[model samples]
Target chain A: MNQLNSTQLETLRNDLKARGLSLFVLKDELLDHICCLIELEMEKGISFDEGRQIVFKNFNSAEMLRNQKKTKWIYQSKKFKRKFKSVLSAAAVIMLMMVGGVEAQETPDGHPIYGDCELASGFGIRRDPIYKIKRMHSGIDFKAKAGTPVVATADGTVLEAVSNPDGYGNKIIISHSGEYKTLFGHLSGFNVKTGDKVRKGDIIGYVGSSGRSSAPHLHYEILQGDKKINPELFISK
Target chain B: MYSKELMKGTLKTIVLKLLKEHEKMYGYEITQKVKDLTQDKIQLTEGALYPTLHKLESLGYVYTEKKEYNGRTRKYYLLTESGQAEATEKINEFAEFVLTMKFIFNSKLAAE
Candidate 1:
């Protein structure tokens, strides 16, 4: 394997540092992967300079940095105190209703209003565009262009549609039957407000790159009472 | 270049054989081992390696443990008991295949 020169290693170190990875965290194996790729390209008649360019173009530095941040957040978030007790408090009331043997009326088709959906981003560790931290994605992202109509995923009453400091940008939450709730975040504008009755597929808002998003995407979530479930399991793909 | 179809068939066997020898490995380590063991005849890219690891993990062939190393916590993967058994079977299967192909090719050369 062709070894990288001191200058080349320094340049790589600086680039990684700029991307939020500390030198202490640099894994020799990952560095070797980069070096091997460069050597392979050089053997293919590509010049060293050209190989370097190809490496930078193909490997996503931002995404790698984001993954590192996510690893940190996963460990730290477990210890952070909960700020919103009200959300959990409301969930308890819904749990009690279910325990009382009151079967929540199932809507026609027994499916949430929206039938087809595509995952924009999964709920898990991801690079936060705003904070540059590896944080819990918390929700699924849906592909929605700017001004594209956002629909309610289920039959529910709008619980909140106020702009607050939670960094959801312009967000809305709806309380559906069976203690289920859906959250829509990073909305450009909202059509439904608090206490508005909405059916599945109702145009509740428009997609926008609001509040902590790097691009225009709809952050959709489903919560059973307070705990979030994988929306992909419930939504039609 | 080897046909993509042929490469796909042996990929799982190749990965399993490597992991069978080591206690645990991460994405980069797995890729490096493949290249070294093959003497640069084969190369595994990131796009290929990650999806395979995830699929193997999901299939219960591999399990991951996060360990703090070099000031960063990295997820290392190790084979389960089932995975070890599968690895032995795959290696034997592949070895028999190579022997059969070599005998046939050498006989053809001698006849020519």
Candidate 2:
């Protein structure tokens, strides 16, 4: 298995680009993978062209990667779409149900719930004890006495921290890596402001009944983009 | 050989869970690891592995760092915070699935 000459590697890059595998990261990754596979095959007495063919064959359809067709594959028939959606959603539901049983719940890469607080409410729709009407609660509320320090659930850059705000009287929103954004709502005071970088358990505010609420609580929400998933999905209680 | 169709649904979960246990891994290392663990019975073709890893990267569950090793560039994958939580959840769920399969299989064996 000879190392691919720079000229051959260049040709492969152009071929891949012409086939719609253009993202540098994706291209480099695939290039390395294919080169390695080809080397293995060539070591077994196959020529480079034959090795390349075998590699492409194992991938099933390098031709299908051609730019325009890549789009088509994603937006194809409704039948394909339906089947794909069911498989993904099934996995999601299973993930949610199986979380609490393991010690891996510590989430080695993420920060734990900050500043010790008790759960006032969990996520989901419920009869609002305050307004006496059914309402969808987008986040979990932790019972913290007024002025108890509220901390960031994970490391991130503060998106906003409002003081004496309306509706949500005091709120702090922090955006973390990996598409995560956390909101600490109805605070008594602000310790961090917009654009401030914070770490896990960093004090960002104080608990209070500042917003439209009935008691001193920290309204904690974890969002992936704008989608509000259950916070309990990620953090252990 | 393992059924490719059966392997399809679990590949992402497997990759995420793998990265969770190790600090970082390159593309070929993951394939070799899976194959070794499964005793060559479950070779992950790059076709199956890379797309899944790329999808996970795009979704921000995992991210990559590139380094030069022995005159070649290798891309190492690591779990982001979200990826860590996701891997935990996915692995737990997969364990439950395998257990359920075993239970069903045992009952059928007894009945037979």
Candidate 3:
């Protein structure tokens, strides 16, 4: 079998690129796959172009080329979407988990509000409505009527659902993959219990003035590990 | 040629078992290895092979190691620690599935 010289390989690369095999890793693998196919064909005593013809006839489907993009996007996006549940035993080896980690970003579906809602207040320090003192707001507050259904921001397990007196009146915390936790505060009621599985946009409770609140609203907090970061980093008005 | 449906259902398990036995392999090597072992009866097309490999990689079951081969960079897939464990599970699952298939298919009429 004749080996494909560098010029022949380069020409093949351009041929594939012209046909939309531009995804780097896939293009590289296809280059190798095509080379192997051509070599195998040549082993049968066929000429180089004849072997190339066979490879092109087989691999040059529009559907196959479309897969180059679709698979790349799915892999790239899911690479960022962490689901530690399936294989937590090997999480330690995933370096991406160490750096980027799982984060609460804009969920690709309906927002946490069930019907009508607006941002009453956002993440950052502001003057306490009643106390009139500047204090840090740990989460974003959505203004909604009491008993407005509140959905989960992402897929997670209900971590806690309790009415505490000290602060955060009736609250529900859901633990997501990659150590992401979302807190829903001032709920009038809960639709989920601790350890219950919830999906993105799944209604977990009803908004209310339950905990340390002056009005009916939803206090949404996104926590990385345990630290409360800006909910706006992920959600918005 | 094998039915695409059967191949689709079995491909992940097959790829996982192959990776478990081979330790590491490039895309071409994997296709070639499977063809050789199965006597070309189960030829895996590029369309099927790549999407499966990418899905596995995204699932954290496999990781990539890039190496320059024949003046071009080739991405080699190596099973992660969890991937190896998953491979064993997949193999056993497929075995059980086959057994279940036998029980279902081999059952004769009760003469009712």
Candidate 4:
């Protein structure tokens, strides 16, 4: 195998990092994989620099970025699942003693509504976009152009799909089983009505500035029982 | 080569099966093996392969260890016990699916 000299390896790493592969968890693996490819090219009588160029051309930055996002999502989801499993085991033991039975439900894991859209604002206390006063932000805000289709994060029945000019501008709340519900706020229009059953990824509304004063975006919330949880935990690219 | 859609959902099973047989393999080795096995008919790109490998690692189906090789770090992936079980399950499931597909195609041919 043709070995990459230290300088050549450094150049390869820099180029990949510059292309946004630096933060990826599999960064070292990818670098090594690319190096192996370059070495194979070199064995074909190609110089290291020429081989590097040829190998680099095969990597699409956008697609590679998508892969990085996907791997990160899988890692987080697995971690969450592990944590949830332990919690469930403890809860089950307590519930069994109390009620002599337990009902298990699947947690919601959903594709991002805007497919890796920019997060304009996140959950928790932050300056209110409207008033500039620090307050609890109920949901995460995703920047989207007006009229972008908003999909249901999980299969559920629409509980409230109403148009109002107030707090959550044209909002829709879908109540899923297992005491879970999702709210879609700032929609331009609704695709379903109250009591309509929608599957995961079903287009339920369009992004708009119907209620709150802001640029076009989607305000999304995930609620378990009566308490709101961070939507970022369940959403993935 | 098959369209990406045709290859969809098989990458994980393929990688797991490969790891199960090989005991351990690196990312590039797995890709090269797939290419050779399929006679260059199915090429697994870096974009598809690495993410699947990472997902498997996260799911506890595979574990990795870094070793020094040729003055650079090389990561090798091997199946966990659960990964071994999963590989058998996935391979069986895929085999059954292929048989069903063949049955359907054969029936369509008979009808025609």
Residue A143 alpha-carbon offset, candidate 1, angstroms: 69
- Model 4, A1-237: lDDT tens digits are 778888888898899889889754777888899899999999999899899889988877788889888888887888889999999999988888656321233245675364435789999999887899999998899888888888988788899999889988899999886678999998998999999998888999988887885788889998999899999898763
Against the native complex, each candidate's DockQ, computed on alpha carbons, is: 0.07, 0.10, 0.38, 0.46
Worst 10 residues of 2 chain A by lDDT: A101-110
* Candidate closer to the true structure by DockQ (higher is better), 2 or 3: 3
Candidate 3 chain A, poorest ten consecutive residues by summed lDDT:
A101-110
Q: Candidate 1's C-alpha lDDT?
A: 0.71
Q: Which stretches of candidate 2 lie over 4 Å from their true place?
A: A18-20, A23-25, A45-50, A62-237, B68-73
Off by over 4 Å in 3: A79-237, B109-112
**DockQ: the better of candidates 1 and 4:** 4
lDDT of each: 0.71, 0.76, 0.83, 0.86
By lDDT: ranked, best first = 4, 3, 2, 1
True contacts kept of 1: 0.02
Q: Candidate 2: TM-score? A: 0.46
Alpha-carbon shift of residue A11 in model 2 (angstroms): 3.1
Clashing pairs in 4: A169-A211
Better of 3 and 4 by DockQ: 4
What TM-score fits each model? 0.36, 0.46, 0.55, 0.58
lDDT of 2 at A55: 74
